[model samples]
Target: MRVVIGEDSVLLREGLVRLLNTSGFEVLAALGDAETTLTAVEEHQPDLVVIDVRMPPSFTDEGLRAALVIRRQWPSIAVLVLSQYVEEQFASELLSGNTRGVGYLLKDRVADVGEFLAALRRVAEGGTALDPEVVAQILVRRRSAPLDRLTPREQEVLALMAEGRSNSAIAGALFITDSAVGKHVNNIFAKLGLPPADNDHRRVLAVLQYLNERPK
Candidate 1:
């Protein structure tokens, strides 16, 4: 996989370059600012971009805004944003559009190299990989009536789904059988009134419903 990194922190940026290099990824460029990152993307057209949510100058979402622009201009380029904390609004905005090839993880996740690499690979391969904390925030803020209809187990299943966990993964996390996970997923889809479609599409829609719903 080819990648470009955008992080203002010298230590983290160098660390990421080394990490990706050793993990079998070709690092095209390591940039410090959002503008240069965008330019690098245009120049390199990498398969994936690993960006910190904040960067140079004002240091308030410049990287995120650049990421949104990258998604707009190069939909095929996967984006994996790292943040110091859970920024629900940013995460929601990033996910509000096409959920494919997108990831939102906290910086703390980087310490777990194996898991972090898994998430990067997942996003690069056109899949979602939201941090567990990000998924939890979205679930907590969801106040839609349809969500209220879900049982506690169903809610748990949906939360794991939002985190982009497969049925077997969800079952393992919940200590349940795959059959039970499937049943709960079906129930979640039915309750959300999602029309029949690709199972992956339905899962994305279910997750979007959680993000799009407003308290009333």
Candidate 2:
């Protein structure tokens, strides 16, 4: 697969290019800044982009913002973001819409070449690969929110939604009918104050609200 890399660190950028090259991925460009990375992606239209969460200039979410733009402008390109720490907000924003072909992994995972390459391959093949820490933190944030308005069943459905389960899968997990799961999902969306919109995925918005709202 064709790949573009956006990492500010010289050693890391070169290392990633070498690793991906050896793994049979064509490294179109290994860029050091978010802008250059964006330019390269626009120029090459690579199949996948591997980016660090922080990049040159401010070094605070530049890479992430660039990734978001890429996702919006070129939805076909896969994105794999690497962060030194569990930036829950970054992960939440990146996952707020259609999450296919996305990945968020910690930088430490690079040492385990097999796992890192597996994650890259999964994302390139239009699958998700989130770090365990990222998932745990997002769940913890959701749990800390004040959600007294939702019924117990609705809360259960919402939790399953956060796990990226489809309505049918949730129904199977809860041993309920698919219709029941749909009702619970709609209820969760209503309780979260999310109205039906033509361009929005209410299910994703509901989960995002659950993750972002603070305990009242």
Candidate 3:
């Protein structure tokens, strides 16, 4: 797989390039800021882009803006943003289009090499891989009307789903059987009016709905 790295820190950039290369990914470019990342993408057309949340110039959200632009300009390429903070709003904005090929993982989570590589592969194949911490932060915020309708347990299940957990994983996390987790998932889906037909991105759709993305 061809990959691009967008990180301001030289050490982290080199580390990512080395890791990806060791894992058999061709590192087309290890860029410093969003501008160079964008330029590299245009020049290399890599299969996956691993970018940090902050970058040169403002160092606030330039990398995120570049990811958004990449999503708009070239939806085929996958984007996985590694951030130091949870930053739910920025993560939501990246997945705003409601399709796939996007991911947002916390920097600390990178220590788990197995999970990190799995998430990278998942996003590359057009799957959402939001960190569980990201989902928890989103639910930790203020509660709204529609969200108020869901029971606390259902809310917990929904949050796990938003984190890209499978039924078995949720079951393991919640200390329940897979059947029980499946039931909770179905109930949450039904209550949220999310069709079971499109199961792949249902978690993302459920999250977008919970955030009240629809026109008010």
Candidate 4:
């Protein structure tokens, strides 16, 4: 897939591009900052974008802010955000719009080339992908109210669901049958007030909404 790289650190940016290239993905552009990344996206229209959580000028959340703009401007372009740390607020913002093509993986995950590539592919295919760490953080921070209404098993299902795991995948991970997983998922949805008909993105939106509303 054609992909763009955005990171303030030149070394990490080049490293990511080289790794992606070695993994058989085309690097359309490797940019040093969010502004350049945005410009490259407009010009190249890459199939996917790999961006750092923090980028130039502010050395803060420029890449994330840029991702939001890109999502609004070019809803079809898939985005994968990599960060050294977890940012529940940013993840909530990214999926808040209920868009289908987005990923938020921790930078440490890059050590597993296969999983990283898989996440990239999933996002490009119009699926949500969030780091398991981020999910855990969100659960810990918002352990009352909406999330508290869930049973432990239901909470496990919701956590996997937030990590973008499908029914079969979650079942395999939890050592349960797909039907059992589906039942748990339905229960979680009912508790979360997420419509049974909602897809991955909408599920993400509902969960994010719940997390965002929790006391900080």
Candidate 5:
């Protein structure tokens, strides 16, 4: 997969290039700021963009906003956002609709090569990858009676789903196999009274339902 990287930290930027290259992904360009990253992405049109949630000029949500822009402008390109912290609101915004090829993961997740590569591949293949932390944060504030029926582990899986994570990413985060994660997802939907569609889109639907019930 060809990729464009966006991050302000020099070490992390170089490290990501090296890591993705070593893993057989082509690094089209490694940019230090979101502005250049956007330009590079538009010019090169890489298969995927791995960006930090926060980037230069503000160190806040510039990268996140840039990602939103990319999603709007280039809906076909995949995006994977890495952050030190997982904000529920940000996750919601990123996964606001049925947008595919999107990811929101914590920075620490980079240390797990298997997981990170899996996420990259998933996004590249037009799937979603989300950090378990983001999922936990969303679930913490939601008040769903059906969610109460799940076991803690199952709940964790459900939260990961809300964050747009795939079965493989959830398995990697939870230290389980993808098959086990699939079972957990099935149980979650069954407990929540959702149909057995087995589509990741259903996960987003479930999240939106929970978000709608919360007192925003």
Candidate 6:
């Protein structure tokens, strides 16, 4: 896949370039500021953009605004937003339109190569990949009855599910058998009123429910 990287940190930017290259991605350009990044996208029109949520000048939301503009102007290009902190509002904004080819992940997640690369590939292939931390934060303050219908374990499983984890991944993370995870998933879907469907459809439904719910 072809990619453009927009990050202000020198070390991180270089590291990302190396990582993507090593992972078989073609890095078109590694840029520092938002404007150059935007220009690069206009010029190269890469398949994906890996950008930090903050960048030069104000160092607060510049990269994010640029990313939003890129999505609006060049919707064909996938975007993966990396941030140190979880911004529910920012994540919601990126997901405001079609969730396809959009991602919001914590910078810390990059340390986990397997997870990070999987998220990147998913986004590049026109899928949603929100950070697990982001999902947890969004669902944290809610106390709705439908959600309450889910047991605590089910709730945890749903959170990871929203992060695009597979049944095996969830099982490994929670140190349980895959069959147990599968049961929890079915219960979650039933409790949330999600009918049987393909796993991706179910995932989108569950995530949309979590995103659309009002915090109590």
Considering every candidate listed, which one attains the maximal TM-score? 2
The global C-alpha lDDT for each of the candidates, from Candidate 1 onward, is: 0.86, 0.86, 0.80, 0.80, 0.81, 0.83
| Segments of candidate 2 deviating more than 4 angstroms | 147-216
Could you give candidate 5's per-residue lDDT for residues 1-120 as a string of tens digits? 999999899998998899899998999999989999999999999999999988889898888888878887888999999999875555666776545899988987668789889999
lDDT winner between candidates 1 and 6? 1
**TM-scores, each model vs. reference:** 0.66, 0.70, 0.65, 0.64, 0.65, 0.64
* Pick by lDDT: 2 or 6, better one: 2
lDDT of 1 at 36: 97
Expressed as tens digits, the lDDT of each residue in 148-215 for candidate 6 is: 68788988888888788999999999999999999998887666655442223767777777656625
Per-residue error at 177 for model 6, in Å? Answer: 62
Give a tens-digit lDDT track for model 1, residues 107-215. Answer: 9766789989999999999999888898887665443337779899998898888788999999999999999999999888767755342223778889888666524
Off by over 4 Å in 1: 144-216
C-alpha RMSD of each candidate structure in angstroms: 13.5, 10.3, 13.7, 13.3, 14.5, 14.4
Q: How close is candidate 2 to the true structure, as a TM-score?
A: 0.70
Candidate 1 Cα RMSD (Å) = 13.5
Please provide, for model 2 over 1-216, each residue's C-alpha lDDT reduced to its tens digit, 9 standing for 90 to 100: 999999999998999999999999999999999999999999999999999988889989999889888998999999999999877665776786778899999887667888889989999999999988889987776555456778889888888888899999999999999999988887776556454433567777787776766254
> Cα lDDT for residue 8, model 5?
90
Stretches of candidate 6 exceeding 4 Å from the true structure: 140-216
List model 4 lDDT by residue over 1-216, tens digit each.
899989888788888888889887999999999999999999999989989888889788888888887887888999989888876555665765665888888887678777878888899889988888877876654443377787999888777876778889999999999999988877776566443221245567655854665457
